[model samples]
Target: MDMKIMRAIELGKTYRDGEKETEVLRQINLEIEEGEFVTIAGPSGSGKSTLLGLLAGLDKPTTGQVFIGENEITSLNENLLAKIRGKMLGFVFQSFNLIPTLNTLENIELPLFLNKIHDVNRAKELIDLVGLSHRSKHYPNQLSGGEQQRVAIARALVCDPPIILADEPTGNLDSRNSKTVIDLLVNLSAEKSKTVIVVTHDLDFAQKAKRVIHINDGRIQ
Candidate 1:
């Protein structure tokens, strides 16, 4: 049998506060095929984001393993994880985390710079794709919330990573903006054959995905 593009086997996560231990995720067994668009829906503090982080190698799991393509991410060190993240994963957070001082062009270029690819034209193309070409010179503070979020999307796509893990991407948007962003994400993922994993509490948003994995109290149901 062929190995899946991504896999999580008996995954678990725990956090400690003072003398207490809080178990966040328990025995998460998942497999993601290449080019799949998957979503995880759960209530707050149900470990949805925690799963994303572990899968993306942004955080370490207390037990079990996570694999991206053929790479066992949990076996790698932090430096290796950073390299893998640069080459394989993209993330979109609910906060639309953009640097306030950078203009659209500069913000989109940040990822490329981190990867040491000096290509300004690539950044311009992403700005155009996200419908922010006209705002290329505008700072994040100058753009509307929706526009800023679009810029964030552009930044995430700049590296052309194969996997995109988005956490509540549209949570801060209005209805129309939410639709616009979600539609753009779906379209982009399909066009690029990217694996898109979104975590959201919105039933309508989750339903649009090819597969929706429901989570309650840290276990997939």
Candidate 2:
């Protein structure tokens, strides 16, 4: 049996401001098998990114449970959640949030340093894997958009996390770079046996997933 790497049960999220409340996701139940590539697709304002954040343990659900491997993360405190996230999840954002002062190698190794692990070898391996080895000494401002995003992907993988969550990873790239990023993400699951989940509004990108979960109005459609 394939391991159920990630699961969400009756998940929901709502934001409250003053007396107004806005419910974004509701009763979203999902399961992702180990080594599977999945995409959550929906129109803008349909809560796709919200769901991704929840599953990544970056945000807490207003109601329900989320399981990453055997850990039910919905109720884990910030410190515990951070610990689990560091060990099990790698996230790539559409914005490619690389530090301005850090070079590609430094950025990739940041996660390792955060965990008190000093392994330049692992960081270099990831940079090479992402084809950024030559640009290791280049700062974020010194690289092109595609290169920068690649660095972000390498940084995400440097920790050797089992699962990767990307939110609209191709949103900032041209067609060619988008294809490159998509191919890398696909290979992570197909070849590396890592569970990869992406939240994207682009139909083309969503189609790349082995399983596409269509979400609309906070519910799976």
Candidate 3:
């Protein structure tokens, strides 16, 4: 099997405000293989999220290369990147980021709708996998934080992307909810043979991963 899911070579990200420049990540090199569950942990001001964005092709690096499978994401334009992202990656955000007006079922089906996959059965299966079948008709606003996040997870997995990128996925949930989401994420990755990379400030969450990378002061420690 082709084991390489993502690779970063000398990756760097810098932010500019007025005359000052902030270096977020510098000379970072990493590799994530297929079927791996890896967590990146760092301090609040560290570059965990920045690195995640780069790895997901959400943001471009100031310097270096990012390869997703056989494609060089750094060299691709936004249109091409978006296409690749749609086909190969899924994302879970801290805020859940669901459309306010859409119900759980509709929210989970949005990606498929966008990609023109009109399979309601597939979407229902994802909801069942997240154990949210009963809440499928509830809107994001009507559900609890955990329920909303579960809907987010169902949405993310609906596409069945080989790579899942989660940024503080459990940040807004309570302890029990956090555990539920984390366990579901881990189980999904293992069962589906997906590559999972999460950026989080929670050490416990990091420890749950098969491999953990510590980032501090813009470098992997």
Candidate 2 matches the true fold with a TM-score of 0.96
Supply every candidate's count of residue pairs whose N, Cα or C atoms clash at under 3 angstroms: 0, 0, 0
- On residues 92-183, what C-alpha lDDT tens digit does candidate 3 reach at each position? 99999999999999999999987777776999999898899899889888999999999998898898899999999999999999999998
Candidate 2, superposed: residue stretches over 4 Å from native: none
lDDT of 3 at 40: 91
Candidate 2 per-residue C-alpha lDDT over 1-221 given as tens digits, one digit per residue, 9 for 90 to 100: 53899999999999889999999999999889989999888788999889999999888899999999999998888899999999999999999999999999899999998877777589889888988878999999999899999999998998889999999998999989888898999999989999999887667767777689988888999
Cα error, candidate 2, residue 173 (Å): 0.3
lDDT of each: 0.89, 0.90, 0.90
Residue 162 lDDT, candidate 3, scale 0-100: 93
Q: What is the lDDT of candidate 3?
A: 0.90
Overlapping backbone residue pairs in candidate 3 total 0
Query: Per-residue alpha-carbon lDDT of model 1 for 95-213, expressed as tens digits?
Result: 99999989989999999999998886999999888888899999988998889889998898899998888989989988888888888788866888888999987666777787999
For candidate 1, what is the TM-score?
Answer: 0.96
For each candidate, give its TM-score against the true structure. Answer: 0.96, 0.96, 0.96
lDDT of 3 at 34: 90
